[model samples]
Target chain A: MLPVIEAGTGPFTQPPTINPAVTADWLVAFLQDEMRARRSVAKAVIGLSGGVDSAVTAFLCARALGPENVHAIRMPYKHSSPASLADAQLVTDALGIHQHTVEITGAVDGYLQLEPEADARRRGNVMARVRMVVLFDQSAKYAALPVGTGNKTERLLGYFTWHADDTPPINPIGDLYKSQVWELARYLGVPRELIEKAPSADLEADQTDESDLGITYARADAILSHMLEGYSNEQLAERGFTEHDVRLVRRRLDGTHWKRHLPTTAMLTNTAINEFYLRPVDF
Target chain B: MEPPVNLDHRAAPLRVAIVQSKPRKGRYEENLRELGEVFAQLTAAQPAPDLVILPEAALTGYFLEGAVYELALDARRFAADLARTWHEAAGGATVDIACGFFENAGGTYYNSAVYVEVEHGKHCVRHVHRKMFLPTYGVFDEERFLSRGRRLQTFETRFGTMALLICEDVWHAIMPTIAAVKGARVLIVPSAAPGRGIEEDDELGSIARWREILHATAAEHGVYLLYAGLAGFEGGKGMTGSSRVVGPRGRTIVQAPALGAHIVRATLDMREIDLARATLPLLGDLGAVLPDLLLDEELPLPRGLHASGH
Candidate 1:
C-alpha cells in the first residue's frame, strides 16, 4: 500500500498540553461575548449527556452566563442508560444550575413508528434530532441559547449525525479534541468517575464509542492532534506512530472534509453569496 | 572615559530565550517553581542561552484587582532568593534573567522589572526599572494599586547595554526612544496584553499591533529588540503570547504562535547593530536635536483672553 502520511515536516514531535484554568477563562469570555453579540441572550441551555464534552461546555457556560441564567437539559430515551442520567444529574447539582428532564423516547418513537424496519443508524439519528428539538423548545421558553457539546474528534471522524447534534448556534468545546476535553474536564473539577467512565454515544444497547469506531481515544487523538497541527501521515509515522493507525486516522479525516465545510454552491455569478457583502457578527 | 572599541570585531552570537509564561492569579510559589523548571531546561542544553526574558507581572500576575498589595514582593529580599536559585540551576554557567514582578519597598508597592546576572554562585542586581506609565483605562488599573518609577536608566551588561520596558511602557514610542538614546543597544519588553478582537484568519489584532511597533522602533534605532509576552487565561481575559526576536534591520529572527506557552531561542550577532546604525543614522539625528528638546525656564505667555465654552 502507498504510504499514508505525506513525506514532509510535521507540526511538533511532542503532544500539545492545555492549561485548563486558562482554557476555562477563555471559554467563559468567549461564551459571554458570543451570546451577547450573536443572540442577544444572557442565558444558555446545554444538554448534559454524562459525557466530558457536555459537562465542560455546561460548566463554562454556567460560569460565563451565571448559574441563574444557565439551564441543563437531560434528554434520555427509554433505552438510554440510567447511569447516564445519574451522571448528568451529578453535573447539574455540582454546578448549582437549573436542570430539566425531558425524555426523548416519545418524540423519537413517533418518527420510528413510521419506519419500524429502521436500523441502529436511523434510530440513533432520530434520537439525536429529537433531543435537539426538545432542547430548543427549552431554549425559547427560558430565553436561552442552546450550546453545542460536539467536540472536534467526533466532528473530524463524522461520528455525529449530519445536522442533529451539530445544530447549536454556539459552542465552546467544538474546537477542543477528545483528549483535550478530558484534560479540560479534570481541570474544571469534574467528578473523577465521569472522566474515568468509558465514552459512549448512548445510541444502542451495549455500545462503547471506541469499540464502535474501531479506534481508541489515545491513538485517535494522538494521530488527529498532530495531523491538525500540520503533520502528515508520513510525519506521524516518523514520530513513532504505527503505520496502520496513521492510515486509518488519515482516511477518516480525509473522508470527513466535506462534512467540515459549508455546503459548496455551484458558482453561477461573479459574486457568490458566501464571498460578497459579508459582515462580522460583532460588527 | 574609556576608548571606544570596534563593535564589528570579536564576533560571537548572543542567545536569548523569551518565555511566554502561563501564570495563574495569586500563585506566587507555583509561578516561582515553574520558573525554576524553565531555568533547569535552558541550562541543561548545550551552549546555554546568554539571557532569558520573562513576561510582566509574572510573580503576582495581572488583573489582581485588589489583592496585588498583599502579594507584592520585597524587591531586595526577592532578588537575593532569585539569585541563589539561579546560581543553583545554572551555576558555573553565566545566564542573566530579566523578569517582571510587583515590588514592595518601604511599605509602597510598584510594578517593576529586575535584571539579575548569575554565574558560579555569584549574582548581582544589575538593573531595576519601575514602570513609568501606569495605565488606568480599559482592562488596566495599575496606577490605582502601585507607584510608578520616576526614572528611565539604561545599564551596561557583558553582552551589550540593554533596557527593560514593562507591558504598557512599550506602547508609547517615547519609552523605546528614551532607552535607545540612553545607550541601550538591545531593548527588551515584557508584556501581559489580553488578546481582544474579532477572530479573523485566526490572527490577533493586538498581537499584530505589537509586532508592528517593535519592528518600527528596532529599524529606526538600528537596535536588537526582544519581546516576551505572557500567555494564559485569568479573570475573563485571554493573555496572548506571541513572543518574538527582531534583528537590527527589523527582520524577525524567530517567533512563536499566539495563545501558547513557548520557550523561544534565537542567535543574534551584536555587530548587526553597528551595521544597521551605520546604514540608517536616526540616532545621530536625534542626538543633534536633543538640545532643542529641553527648556531652561518656563516661557511667558502673551496676554490673551481665555475662551469659555459655549
Candidate 2:
C-alpha cells in the first residue's frame, strides 16, 4: 500500500494527503525546467522568510540548481522577529547556499514617514513589498531569477499582499496547499523548528496565520479541497464541517478570485494580451 | 496509392521506438531542430528503429492556446520538413515516423497527427488523423481554438493495417472499437496528458487512469498498443511521460520513466495479435455485431424518453 500523510482532524473521512517523495521530484523538475530551459537562467534567488513555505522552496531550488546556484535573501523590517532570521539562517547553513541579509527597515520607514498615520495593515503591505524590492534587486545583482514562496492556501484565500509575495516570475510551491507544504517541508528535511512553529506572515508582532484567518490550515485545506471538488456548503456541512467554517472559507475563496489573476485590462482591441490574445507563459 | 514497400514478405518483427519528447511551447523551429538531433542519434544506433512514434504536439508544445495558429504547418509541408531533416542527418536512411502537431489545413486549424514514410531522402504522407474530441473543461480550451476531425481511418503499412489516435480520441471507447473493426492490428496513441491529481498511488492520478484505459483498450481490441507521452512542463503543467508499449494480451512490454525525456523500444511480432485473438476473441465478437450496433444508434429515443433526462 502507498504511504499517506494524514492531515489532522477535519470533516474529511480520508484526510487530504500527497506523496511528498513524488511531489518533491516533480517540483524539482519543474524548477529545473522552468529556470534552465524556459527562462534560460541557471541560478535562482528566493526570499527566505524562515517559514515552511519558503524553506521548502529553498530546498527544491537548491536541489534543482545546485546549492551554489541558489541564493537566499532575508529582508527583515525592524520589528520583524529575530527568531525568523535565525530560522532562515538554519536553512542556508544546512543547505550550504549563498545567504544575504538585507535590512528593509530603512527602506520601509523612508516611505512610511511620508504617510505617518498609516495603519498596521498598510505598514505590513509596505514591508512585504519592500522585501520584494530587495529580493528582485538582489536577483539582478546575482543574475538569477526571483522565485515565489507563496503557497496555494494563501493564494486561494488571497492572504498575500498583491505584487509583493506573489510577484516572482516562478514558484515551485504555489500549487501545493499550506498543509501539503508542511508535509513536504518534513520530507525535504527543513529545520524541524521552522516546520513546527505557527505560520505567520510576520508583518506585525505575534501575527499567526491561523489567528488572522480564524481557521487552522488543516481545516481550511480540507474545506478548500472539498469545495474545489464542487461540493456545496450544504454538502460540506453534511460531511461534518461547521457552517461557520464553511462560509468563511467560501467567502474568502470567492471574494479573492481577482487576486489570483492578472490585472483587468480594457479589451478595446481584439489583440489585447492575456484575454482575446492568449499564449502560454513558456511561449 | 501503391504500397511504400513490398507487403507480401513482411514477416519480420516490427521494431518501434517511442520518443517521449519535451517540445518547447510555441517554439516550433527549435523543437524541430531538437527532433532532428534525436533523429540523427537514432540513425547512428546499431539496431536503428524502423518506426518512431512521438507524443501529441511533438513539433509545438501542448497548451499553445491562441498561438496554435502561429505554429501550425500544413501536412505536406510538415512531412517534407521531417524528410529534409532526416535526409540531412542520415543521408537517405529509410524510417517511418508518426508525430503530432497542430495542423493548418487551408485557413482552418486542427490538433493533428501525421504518419510519414521517409525513404531514401524522399517522404510520402501516408495519413493524417485530426483529433476528434477537444476537451474544453478545466485546464483545457481546445474547442475554442481548433476544429474537430470527423473521420476514423485505418491505413495499410508494410507491417500491416495500423490506426493512429490523438490524445482525446482514445479516451472514447468507440474510437478504438471502430479502428479495430476496420482491420487495424496496431494502435498508435500520441498523447499530451497533463499530470494531475495526487492520490493513494506513487504515480500521478492521470497516469494511473491512462494505464487502465490503455490496457483495457489494447486487450479488448487484441491489437498492439503504442502510447507516446509528452514530457516537460508547459506553463507549469507537467506532461506525464510514461510512454509504453503494450502487447495484444494487455501486458506492458516496455515503459519509460514518468518524468523526463526518454525513448523506449520494443519488438512486436504480428503473430501475437493472432494468438491474443485466438485466446480471448473479444474483437471478433464485437466486429460481428458492429453493423447492427451502428444501425441501432441511428434509431430515435424510446417513447416518453428524451436524449436528456427530464
Candidate 3:
C-alpha cells in the first residue's frame, strides 16, 4: 500500500527495494557474520508462501547465504491453494535449495476439532500456527532459523495471526509494504504468477485480503501512512474515504496499537521492561 | 601494472587501450559478454593498460529510435555484474573503464558514457557523461529521445585526470574546450559516428572531419585525445570505426581501420603535455582569450555577421 512514484516506464514506479548493489553487499555481510556469531550455524530456513513476500525474502536469503545454506519449507493444508504449493516449488527449484513439503492438514484439523464451532478466521489462525510449528522443527533439524514473510501493510492492518507469521528470527521483508513488495519481487526475479496472484490468507475458499478488508491495499496503505504522519480523521476523509470507512480504520488503528509492541508487564517493580530491559532482534 | 596497452616503460606514462566494438543493436547482455572476452584478452597482456576505452553506446548500439529507452542500462546492477566479470576474467586486476550506453536518469533517456573503476572485485562509477549535443537531422535524431547533458566536466581517476564526452559532444569545440579547462590531461570521446563518402583512402567525410577536430583539440590543449568509435551495420546505418589515439603534437599514435573492430593501444608521456604547451603557449594564453566566464550583457553584433536588428 505504498505510492508508486515514477511508474509509467515499467509496471513498477521506483522499486521500493534497496538498491541491488547495496542490498547484496549488506545482506551477504549481515547473514554470514550473524550466522557465525549468534546462531553458530551457516544456514537459514524459510517457509515459502506462494506470495511475493516470502519469495523475495527467500531470494535475498539465497543470495546472502548461498542456496546450499538455505532450506525452503512448504507447509500446506487440505484447503491451501494448489497454486501456492506450485509457487513454493518454483522458488525452491530456481534457487536450488533444499526443499521440504510438510502438509499441516493433520495438525490443523486436530486443533480445529477441539473447537468445532470456530469460524474460518479462527481455523486459519490454527493452520498458520501449525505451519510455524512445522517450520521451526525443520529449522532446528537443519541448524537454521525461520525467516518471517509478513510485510508492513499486513502488520499495520493486523492481517497476520499473532505469534504465527510474526514469530521469526529474521524478517527482511517486514519493513516493506505490499506495493513495495511487488517492486522488489520484480527486481528479485520472482515468478510473475506469484507476484500477480491475488493476495489471500488461503484460510477459506475464495478469500482475498482486499475482499476481507473492504478496502484496496493501494488506497489503505496511502491512508495508513498519511494517518501515521498525524493526518487527522477529518483530513483523511478529505483526502478520500467515506466517514464510515474512516471511522472503521481509525478504530482498528486504535485497537491494533497493542499488537505492534512487546507484551507490557504490570509496573510493580522499580523499572519496567519497556523502560529498563531492551533487547534488539539479531540473528 | 596498467590494464593491456603498454608499448614501453616510461615515467608517469599513461597507457590507454581503445576498444572499437560492434554492438548487436539493442542486445545489452550480448554486448557485455563480448566486452568480457575483450577484457579477458587484455588481462593476459604484459603491463595492462591504465585506462580502457570502449565505443559510444557499446552497451547498446546507437540509433535505437524508440526502443533505446527500454534498452537504457541500469548502471548500478549492470556495473556490478560487469565488474565481477572483469575481476574474474582479469584475475583481480584493477582498471579504469570508460564506455557508453543509453542511461535511464530520472525517467529521461540520456546518451551517456559511464566511467567505471574496479579494484579487487569492487567497482565504482566515477563519472556519467550524458550526451550534450543531440543531433536531430539526417540519420541523427538523438534529441527526439535523449535528454541533453547539463555539464561538460572532467574527473580524476587512479591513472590520471580525465574527461569523457559522448559522440557529438566532440563535434562542438566548446565541449572539448570546457573539459580541457577543467584540468583534464586526457580528453576522451566515445563516439558512434558513421562513415560517410567514398574516397580513394577510405578516410573521408565523417572520418576525415572527426580526425581534423581530434587533432586540433589535442594539439591545442596539449592533452592526449582518445576517440573510441563503434563499428557495426544496424538497419543500414554503418557506424564508422576510426577509433584512434592522438598525441599532444597532433600525431596519430594508433588508429583502428575504418569500419572494423580493433584494439588500439598507445603509451602517453605525461610530461609531453607541459612540453607542448610550453612550446606553443596557446593553451597557456587560453585564460586571456576565454576563461569560461559568463556575461549576460548584450553586445550588438558585428555588421557583416548578421542582419541589422533595427
Candidate 4:
C-alpha cells in the first residue's frame, strides 16, 4: 500500500502520485517491446543495488523477461555496507533470477591508486564507473541487454554519475521519479527492509543520498515536479516550500542539463546525428 | 475502385473489430504478417466483422520523425498489399479495413489513413483521409515532418456515410461537428496517443481525456464513434491502447485493455443514430441553423461590436 499524499498541504506534501498497477503493466510491456524492437534480445542484465530504484527495476525486468532470463549483478566495493549486499541477495532469491557477485574494491582501487589526492566525490565516481564496467562486461558475457536503473529524480537533479549509471541503452524506470520509484517498489512487493532503508549510493561510509543532496527525495521530487509544471520559485514558496530547498533543487537541475543529454556535437552539415538526422531510438 | 453497395436504408447492424495493434517500428513486412494472423483469427469467428479498424500508423509505428519518408507507401500500393494479405488469410471473405499509414502522395509525405474494401484477391480504395491536424507540441513533432491534410469530408461505405479522423483531429471540437453536419453517421478515429500524466486514478490522464472527447463527440453528433488506439512502446513512450466504441447515447459499448495488443468487438446499429437524434435533436437543430450561421460568419462585424450590442 502507498501513502496518500493530499494536495495543498505543504510543498513536500504533493509529490506526483501514480497508478502503480497500471504503471507496472505499462512498464513490463515497454521492456518487452523495446528490448526486442530492433533486435531479438530476450534477456536483461541489471545491476542490483538493493535500493528501491534498482529493486523495482529488477522486479519489472523479472516480470517482463522471465526470471530465468534476468541476470542480477551485485557489484559491491570493500567499504560498501554488508546489509546492502544482503538486501540485493534477498531480491534475487525472491525473484529466482540469476545472481553474480563481483567485488569492485580491487578494480576501483587499481585506478584510484594513482589519484591518491582524489576527494570522496572523485573516488565515488571511479567506483560507479567501475561498477558499470563490470555490469557491461557481465552483460556481454551473458548475451543480455544492460538495463539502466536510474530514476527520473536522479536524472533531473543530476545525482547520478554521468556515463556510468545512465549509460544503458534502455531504462524501464528512467521516467519515474525517485519518490514514484518507492511507490512502485512497494506495489511490486519489494523487501520491506530495503524499502524502509535510507537511500545511498553506498560509495562511502554513512553517506545517505539526502545528506549529499541537501534535500530529501520527497521534497526534491515535489519541487522538481512543480517546477516542470512552470511553477515559479515565489509560487513554490507561497505553496509552503522552503526557499533553501527550492534553490538547491533548481540549481542542481539547471546546472546538470548536460548530464541529461548526449555530448555536444559540432554541426557542420544539414543533417547531424540526433540534432538534424533525427530518428527515434526504436526506429 | 469498385463503388460501395448502397446500404443507406439498411437497418442491419455493422460488426466492427477494433485491433489495438503494436506495429514494430520501421518493420512493415513484420507488421503485415502479424496483421494477417489477426485477420485469420477474425475469419475463424462465427460472425466475422464487416470492418476492422487499426490505430494510427499501424503499418509503421508512430514517432518515425525523418523515417516517415522511408516507410511511407503510395495509396495504391498500400491498398494492394493489404488486399494481398487479407486474401491470403480470409480467402473469399470480404472485409473493410481502415488503417493509418505514412502516405507518399506525389513527392509529399502525409500522415494518412486509408479505408480500403478487400474481397477475395481484390481491394478498392474507398477513401483516404490525410491527418488534418499534425500535433507539434510536447513529445509530438508531426507537423515538422509530415504535411498537413487539407480536406475534411465523409464518404459512402458499405455500412453508410462515415468519416475518418486521425488522433489529433478529434481533439478539436469543430472537426467532429463538421463531419456530422456533412452526413457522417459513424466516425472512425485511429489514434497513437502516448500515455501521459499519472495524476488520474486507475487511468492515464491522456486516456481519460480521450474518453471525454469520444463520448462528447458521439453523444453530440448522435453517431457511433469507433476509436482504435496503437499499443506498445516507441523510445520509452508507451502508446496507451484503450481502444473503444462509443454508442450514440455516449455509452462505451466495448473497450480494450490499457496496454498491449488486444482486439475489441462491437456491433453498432446504425438506426441508433436516428433514435438518439430524435430524442436529443441537437444535430437537427444545428443543421437547421447552419446556413444562417455561415451567413453570419460571411458578414463583417460593425465597428466597436460587442456582446452587449448583440
> Candidate 4, overall lDDT?
0.88
What C-alpha lDDT, on a 0 to 100 scale, does residue A165 get in candidate 3? 90
TM-score of the second chain for every model: 0.90, 0.94, 0.89, 0.94
What is the DockQ of the complex in model 2? 0.01
Candidate 1 stretches with Cα past 4 Å from truth are A1-283, B1-10, B199-202, B296-310
Better of 2 and 4 by lDDT: 4
Model 1 chain A: worst 10 consecutive residues (lDDT sum): A1-10
TM-score of A-chain in each prediction?
0.91, 0.95, 0.86, 0.94
TM-score, one value per model = 0.49, 0.51, 0.48, 0.51
Error of 2 at B24 (Å): 1.6
Residue A248, model 1: lDDT of 86
* lDDT (tens digit, per residue) of candidate 4 on B1-310: 4456576634667888888898899999999998899888887875888999999999789999998889999999898888888899899898999999999999899999999998877788999999999999999999899999999989888788899999999999889999999999999999999999899988999999999989999999999999999999999999998889898878787788777888888767666687778778899999999778766844664434553485
Candidate 1 structure lDDT: 0.81
Residue-level lDDT tens digits of model 1 in A67-131: 88889999999999999999998898889999999988888998899999999998999898888
Global lDDT of each model? 0.81, 0.88, 0.77, 0.88
Ranking by lDDT: 4, 2, 1, 3
Per-residue C-alpha lDDT of model 1 across residues B41-124, encoded as one tens digit per residue: 777876678888888887567888679877888776667767766676667787778888888888888888888877777777
lDDT string for model 3 (A125-219, tens) is 88888888898999999888888889888888888888899998767777767877777778778888888888888788888999888877776
